[model samples]
Target chain A: MTKLLLKKLTKTFERRVIFKDINLEWNGPGLFGIAGPNGSGKSTLVKVVTGLISATAGEITIETDGKKLSPSTAIDYIGFASPYLTLYDEFTAKENLEFAVNIRGQQLDEAKMDQLLEHFSLLKRKNDFVKAYSSGMKQRLKIIFAFIHNPDMIILDEPTANLDAEGKQKVYDLVKQTAKEKMVIFATNEEEELAMCDEIIKILSYQPAGRN
Target chain B: MFRRALWLFNKDLTSELRTRYAINALAMFIIVTISVIMFAIGQETISAALAGGLLWVVIFFSAMSGLSRAFVSEEERGTSLLLQLVASPTVVLTGKLFYNLILVFAMNMVILVLYSALFDAFVLKNVYIFFFSFVLGNTGLAFASTIIASIIAKANSKGTLYPVLSFPILLPLLLMLVEITKRCSEGVKFEDIAPEFFALVSYNVVIAAVSYMLFDFIWKE
Candidate 1:
């Protein structure tokens, strides 16, 4: 099990305040959602949680079995998927997955890779370069990369963007199944995705509390 | 870490083979610059010192054209975020450094062969001195270039910043390379060039070590 804690989290860009004085914790075995409207710092919050971006103030700590994981090493245990994070366009689907697995320092689960590709209906196009993939197909591939490692923490930012009905259903199923024994955090404005979560943290409610 | 670096290096190599963005930039710049030099110095009997300086100038510009793409491509493609989340900064830097080193060496060899053939005065008296200086100079060049590429990848004015930032850092290294190559052209022995050889070695070591230490912050920031 993994536990994530955020204490007095605040993020400011220039003079604009995105979120302030936010405190939250999730000891997860279920889906947790961070819901906010467009440009309400949903992606920024997710980036901070994943340590891709630093917060202006506060600390984020990930602990497993009473051992704390530093932000520097948080990525090893986290899987992140977002529209802003693109795969290598010049590489085929399989090559991109190989690249990701290599960098993640994880064994290439050939069986699992094929299974996921088949599940996502992408097995036929696995040899084609990602540059040829449609937006929806690319989105599905991103989700596939995130889950390939079966990481301890799964973070999906705008998970269902550009997905068709069937593709959306496929992601929902995987999120449901994986969250059973891992940490899953979804950042989306879509109520449909939020409804799947065990709890929802609204960004608007995180307005500066007592200016601290 | 080495495995991951190799993976990154291979990824860049494969991509370069497919797109040829960096290679094209390097080849065009090298060919055009060398052609211009050959034309301007058609019948002049240039001294070995001048020839050596001219050779390093060609390498310096060629490196500038090619190495800037190391990190800029990732930022442009939006793959920077994915790489940041997946790989350690050291691994990324190592991969980029290796790629740049290969590129610099290959380009330098082309320039060396062409420069010697085109200019009769570009004779090397000591092959050993020239070879070691060439290798070490390229190593230092790649190390500094890779880190500077990473720093400028996040800047607003990427194209302008690359050469501007690289010029100051690479000036001293270029001077040493030019001096050692000049001695080689003058038929100086390896023992005679020891001071310059040691200076080149020290420069490469210092640049590599400092770049490795500073890259994490630049990469993460």
Candidate 2:
């Protein structure tokens, strides 16, 4: 099990305060949602939690099996998929997954990779270059990159932005199943996705007085 | 760390082989710069100092064109976040550093062979001094260039920003390399180039250490 805590977290860009004094304690074998209107600091919070961007103030703590992770090594235990993140287009789907796994200091298990590809219905195109994949396919591959490592937590930012209805279902199903064993956090504006969350973090509540 | 770094290096090599962006840019710049030099020098007999200085000038500008792609491509392709999410800042820097090392080394040796063959005046009597300078020079160049590439990758006007940022950072290394090359062409003994060799070593060591420390800040921001 994974336990995540955010204590008085704040983020600012230049003079604009993105979010202020946000705190949450989520211990999960379930899904958590971050819901806010456009530009409401949902993605900012996700970046902070994932350590992609540093928090302006306060602290974030992650623990798995009662062992606390230091800030530097915390990223290794979290899987993050973002709209702004992309795979190496020059590589095949399998090769891209291999690189992701290898870079994380683990060898790729071909059977697991093949299983994930099959589950995502990308098995036929497994050997094709990511650049040749459609937007939906690329998004699916991004999802695989996040899940292949089986991190303690999985964070998705705008997870369904490019997906069609069927692609959305595949991701939703995987997130639901994965949540039984790992922490799942979604930063999304979609009502369907929001409905699936066990707890919701609304960015507006953390907004500074005048900004909201 | 080394294993992860090697994964990144291998991934980059595969991507590079497919796209050929860096190799193409380096090759094109080297050929054009050397050809232009030949045309400008025509029948004139150039001095060893001029040839040595011109050699690194080509390399400096060529590096400005090619090595910037090391980090700039990741930023452009929006894969910087993927790397940050997967690897630590040090591993990312070391991976890109080694890739640039291979590239600059290969590019420098090619340019050296061609520069020596064409100039005639820049003949190296002490291959040992030239070899030491070549290894040290490429290491320092790659070290400095990789860090600068990460900085400029985040800037607004990336193209014009690279050389402007790189020239200042790389000036000390360039000056030392030029002098070493000049001495090598003049048939100077290895010991005679000790001060310069040691200077190159210091420049490389300092730059390598500073780059590792500073890269974490540059990369995460």
Candidate 3:
């Protein structure tokens, strides 16, 4: 139902090349992974995929239901979670969720909210300010936030960075359930997590073609 | 977009209540500056024009202190990414602008009351004109400040950049506000001050339109 295509993608910061000449096409429903060592552009590639940062050069086209979407419109289809992204620390978890949902113009799906909270074991602490949450709890909250809209494309960078084993299992289960009918892109160095992907792209592979 | 803006406004209000960041900064600057001015003029009667200009000077600096944090705080807290991912640029801009508008209006009303009582600057016949001018002026201030806040949010030296960017853009608006305030103090008729009103309204519309057109690039970049 959704497809993503990147053509000759190049990204550079201050004349230092991050990656170049990347081309790929992905169609959901499946799990895709972007894997690389640290500083190998794994995060940058994920950011590019989610439109969080502009590429130095290239084109990204997202098609849904066979309609090609412009970059601005394509953004609505993406849901992203990253260690770099932050929630409102001053707001309670429920208030944060409400704010996110309201901004997206979606009705509050209380059933889904209850399920996610119970699944993450956060139902009791939903009224607590996010600043009070532990890093693992915050990670679960971020993952939950990404799925709030049930977006056509979900991108998670360092998805399990600080999560405990139990949290990791919850995330893996959520990804499996999500990728069954949507595009899920995970950018991580962990081989265990990458093993879940149907396909993997090493970010290093796109490094300035043939330059060694 | 409007609904989203309201939601953001509420979020800002609640966050402000908890942290007291912008409000505390604005309140401190306002109280300190006004008290200093009152002491400086100790028993010295100043002209309406001088009083009007001083009022604007206090307000402009107070706004510069508080409104710059509208976007800067988001950037510092890393919440801008969350907003960028979930909301459109227009929606984000509208939300920030509304919050700034509420802050500026409320702060200005407090300043107006204090200036009137403390400095004897309320000797005007046409109070309605003053009220309208204050509303329109704050609207323009809100528009310019919100956009500038976003511009400076990404800069390395935000504290310096915010005021530098705001000064030139707000100069004309400030001039018009000062002129209108002076006229109001003198009990000038509404017809005599229509041009100033028109200028303030036009300034708000132009700044808002330009900011809306430019915000997508600024916000995403």
Retained true contacts (fraction), each candidate: 0.80, 0.90, 0.88
lDDT of 1 by residue, A1-212 (tens): 88989999999988788998789999987899999888788899999998888899998988866779886677778899987779999999999998888776778898999999999999999999999999999999999999887788999999999998999999999899999999899999887999999988998734445875
Worst 10 residues of 2 chain B by lDDT: B121-130
Candidate 3 accuracy as TM-score? 0.96
Instruction: State the TM-score of the second chain for every model.
Output: 0.97, 0.97, 0.97
Q: Which of the two candidates, 2 or 3, achieves a greater TM-score against the reference?
A: 2
Per-residue lDDT tens digits for candidate 1, residues B48-87, read 8898899999998888898989899999888898889888
lDDT of 2 at A15: 75
* Model 3 / residue A20 / CA error / Å: 1.0
Ranking by lDDT: 2, 1, 3
Given candidate 3, what's the lDDT at residue A6?
89
Worst 10 residues of 1 chain B by lDDT: B212-221
Off by over 4 Å in 2: A205-207, A210-212
lDDT by candidate, in order shown: 0.89, 0.90, 0.88
Identify the runs in model 3 with alpha carbons over 4 angstroms from their true place.
A205-212
Selected candidate, larger DockQ, 2 vs 3: 2
Which residue pairs overlap in candidate 2's backbone?
none
User: Candidate 3: DockQ?
Assistant: 0.77
